[model samples]
Target: MCRLLGVVTHAPTRLADTLTDLIEPFTGLSREHCDGWGVAAWQPDGELAVSKDVLPAHASPAFAATLAGSVTDAALLHLRMASPGLPTEPRNTHPFSAGALAFAHNGYFAPVEAIDELIDPDLLAGADGDTDSERYFLRVLTRLHDEDPVDALALAAADIRERAQFASLNCLLLTQDALYAYSEENPDSEVSRRRGPDFFRLRYQARAGRVVVASSGIGAQDGDGWSLLPYRQVLEIRRSDLRVSTHLVRGALVGAGG
Candidate 1:
């Protein structure tokens, strides 16, 4: 499991102001999701810059330094809690990137071999780590070449669900111009019982010409402008006008609640 935070603003913004406060207590979450930390931001010239460390967010100076800097219009942050049997290394960190896309996932799926078979040989060759999250990201990236992001992710989610009976697939996908988010989990699974329901729940807030989406409302109070993104839903937030488009990729499953 992991914690994910993504932001899309109407203009260039210092992440320090927008994310500093939100990320302060987030580091505290490292008490559980303490494996590693990573951040990816779009640069002014439309390139993605990623910095990651295999140290807990609460203890890593690199994590603090990365957040103190500025990001052009979008940023993605992740705090990883390694799943059983997976090693904690920089290569296994989140916000995995390829070309202009960066991705982070907060859930786990099993039978790694099954997921690997679904990915193209070329894309699988790009994976630097063995975590299922990286494989999921690559699967989605492969779909990006032929479909829109939302639809591409939907396909990825469907494929995972079919191969793995009990899995959670909540993720945040970032491109230069927009942020795409998805939330889904199998409530009956052991993974869900161990991680707690709120761990997989994702929330978002759209205000002040900005849209912020996260795996949980760690930095935000219950009220404010935040609203829970229902399970099985996907969101597309554009930076140009801060327009948000949402679509339901799967039917709401019974017993699934945030």
Candidate 2:
């Protein structure tokens, strides 16, 4: 598994201090997930700028330099430990983006062929690598960026559940307007999610007018409310309020603000 993090805010903040500098040392939840790390930031006009590599975060000067100067209102990060033959190259890294949305995952899929079938054919150009994480993001982007966002996400999730069995499906999606975190896994038999030790124990930190999402709890402080999000639910977070809606949000209600 890999470590993940994201920052969605109402103001432009320096990621080097919170998400990057904090996770660089060997002292937090993101400490050991240094195999590969990347950041996706939203430009002032809602454009997405992403950078990723297979190198360890603690060692890569490029990533270090990039993070040092990185600042954005919304961003995503992934520190990967490459799965088997997935190849540890820059292209295989995460935070895959389309026009205004950036996506990343922390798990692997079953079959590549089946995963390929779930994605929209025309949006395949966004894919820069063969990793399932990128493919999954591309597929979801195709649906989400379509004329209908809610329908696309539902269709993408259903497509994933039908094909990628016995796998962990933890996804973080950031669009132009808001950010969504869906915590669930579709196993071969039954789908579920666990926290604390094995599965997604990630924390949602809201402080100093900034809200960030990470793969695990870093325990920086107590009063921050750093909540552990629930599984099978979709969290729609904006600048001020964060709301979580129930599962399979109908296409008619997908675009609705949480």
Whose TM-score is greatest here?
Answer: 1
Residue-wise C-alpha lDDT for candidate 2, range 57-112, written one tens digit per residue: 77677676766677677777777866678777778777777677778787777675
Q: Candidate 1 has which clashing residue pairs, if any?
A: none
lDDT of 1 by residue, 86-205 (tens): 999889999899888899998888876657777778999877998889888988887777778887777788778877764578899998678999888889888788767776888888
lDDT of 1 at 179: 93
The C-alpha stretches of model 1 lying farther than 4 A from their native spots are 217-223, 250-258
Q: What lDDT score goes with residue 188 in model 1?
A: 88
TM-score of each: 0.92, 0.79
